[model samples]
Target: MRPRGIFWPGVAGIASGALMLVALVVTYGNSPDYEGRNGLRETVEFYRDAGNRDLTEAMALVMLAAGLLFLFFLAALARVTASRSSLVLVGGILFVALTMIATIAGAIYAITASHTEAFVVTPGTGTVALLLLDVSYAGTVAAMVGAAVLLFAVWRASRTTGAVPQWLAWFGFVIAVLCLAGPFSAWLTVLLMALWTVLAGVVLVLRPPTEA
Candidate 1:
């Protein structure tokens, strides 16, 4: 497999990941801190305010876009690893499903955030929104786990088939270990995975195809 056809998918993956990271930072950085149990009201206010609505929308849209692009990246990865190991293929597919779930959850939260006025007006709506946010975060955690599994499988495949360098395999193992640390480390795991994805894409583009 030449990987020539999949090159654009790699590029799209990197671009989307970059955009998602930037949009996420911009969305959260400018917003007020909404941590702790007492922070729900503040979160409601932040979303309700007209000035912050645009950032909320951007975050939502970018997440959705990133999710779509991530699918492309996963497909390319699965194709690359298919000949190397069945475990890698399965892990890639699982990761794709979990990531899609996370993306949908994120989109739902965005929709909820966009309609803060309605949530505020209707009793219990805010609670529901918060619950949705929790679910979205949970989905993110699960997706990260799926990514960890994929990376681990990739590492195993690399060891057997030499599809990727040993150092890269070790790097994947380290990231996978971090990802398995659960929700508290999710953000850091995500950032690391995003960087890894970009680097992997670049490496795929540059490396010559191996003979089957």
Candidate 2:
């Protein structure tokens, strides 16, 4: 088999992850003290600074698109893996759902962050916005769990069906473990996930399914 449906999903995953990474780097740069610093008041100030609002909104939009693309990629992955094992399919589905929640929460936070004036004046609104942002972090835990499960599923499938290379499955396991380190390791997590996704996509595109 040529892995007919894998090409588009791989492309989508690569594009989605790359776009989000670029957006984050461009918007935040080297500044660790950008948005969500000090407290709700500081966060409001960060966004209220005029120049930051446009960038914040733009970044949010990019992330939103990335999230949508990731969903599509996950759906395709689910389809591809469905015949190998039901557990693997479920893992992909769970990953998709959890990621969607995280993405939506992040977008909401970005929207709220952009509206600096509204949150600045309305005391509690900033807190609410900050809370929403935190919700995304919470969602990441679930997403990581899903990623781990999916990786495990892939590992198991690879062992029997040769659906993916053993090394790729192992790499996924490593990435999944790194992802569990939480917000402190977020940068590493994102980089590893993006690399894995791109590599997986490329492999699926270049190799015949039967070859694996």
Candidate 3:
């Protein structure tokens, strides 16, 4: 396909990353610290506020959109890299799937905390919320692992055959390494991925891979 053919996908990829950043800002900008010693309590308290619950729901929707847009970018990547390997596609699919699951878990947490009065009145309900939060965190870890694999695949393909630039591949490789740390380094991964996705999008728009 011509560069023109990939242009829209590239733009969509840019949107995907931008949406992720937007969602992060919306959810975390004024949110309470849920990573503190009393993390569960903090989360429960935050969601107790109606505004916080609304914001969580909105961000969850945004995240879902971002994940969908990312699939377009992933398909483009597979084409440009000429990667027949199922792992490349699988990795991308895994990231989206796990991320969707994580987002749903978060949304459920918000609902549980806000709508279910018993969540605060009863210990059992609170425990259920806590378990949901754990599921969200685990999903994030698995998603990042999948993202790391996808990035590694890109780096490997770009080493010689893929149309992507070597520098981008190297950057992806580094990000993939960081991604291995999963939730521990997720913040850094988000920042790096935003940059990488934008750069990759630009490349695809400007210079699509051609058959040799």
Candidate 4:
């Protein structure tokens, strides 16, 4: 937790991004019916049946790595010569907690994928419909909530002009807002989320602490 150097967080962020990119490639062009769409059933099956579930699960696990890296980064940040009770601490806690929650959701999604595999074999249209609908509801709620909490943490950090940049926090806050509207626009929300992640990671990696 002792502050090693500002570059350490950058290293961790890059490492996390590497792991995530791998997961993304593995799951590229693949996703499960864990979320239901009126017409996305066939599309979902194509991904799962193409032996892409592992890829999806791998992506899910990357979140665990991302969470750990951030944990270390935050720990180091917490050791800075400032108020330990500063917004940085709150932001750190939120990131850690929400990342863990997201990790859990990923685990659940992997388990559910197995069930979908079997359902694929039997071709149970009615059952598949129900499962997809259920996933849509549960997954959206989990993702939205976790993302919101993480973004809020960034917003919390934003208050500490020394520890975290205001722009990064606002970006995160906007992404969180987008995520809140997932029922109406999940794709847009995800796009914004991805953008926020990249921007924040970069900022955290490069920003130096301000003079108190």
lDDT by residue for model 1 (12-93), tens:
6687668667755675476534467665776666656656756666666776677677777777776666664456556655
User: Candidate 3 at residue 37, lDDT?
Assistant: 81
Q: What TM-score, computed on C-alpha atoms, does each candidate reach?
A: 0.82, 0.76, 0.85, 0.59
User: What's the lDDT for residue 154 in model 1?
Assistant: 83
Considering summed lDDT, which 10 consecutive residues are worst modelled in model 4? 121-130
Deviation from native of the Cα of residue 197 in model 4, angstroms: 3.4
- How many backbone clashes can be found in candidate 2? 0
TM for candidate 2 is 0.76
Residue 28, candidate 4: C-alpha displacement in angstroms = 7.0
Predicted structure 1, TM vs. truth: 0.82
| CA RMSD (A), model 3 | 2.9
Whole-structure CA lDDT of model 2: 0.64
Off by more than 4 A, model 3: 1-4, 112-124, 208-212
lDDT of 3 by residue, 1-212 (tens): 43336788898888888888788667657555655788667665766678877888888999999999989988887777775346668888998899899889867867666677766623445456667767877887788888888888889988867557899999989999999787798766866776787788888778744454
Model 1 steric clash pairs: none
Winner by lDDT: 3
Alpha-carbon error at 155 in model 1, in Å? 0.8
Runs in model 1 deviating more than 4 A are 1-4, 27-32, 83-85, 107-124, 209-212
After best superposition, candidate 2 residue 206: deviation in angstroms? Answer: 0.5
Better of 3 and 4 by TM-score: 3
- What does candidate 2's lDDT look like per residue over 1-212, in tens digits? 44556777888878877876776577446222424346766765655565665665677677667767776676666555555556655665675577667656755654655564454424465566566657766776676676667777776667776777778888987877776777766556655665666676666666544454
lDDT of 1 at 28: 47
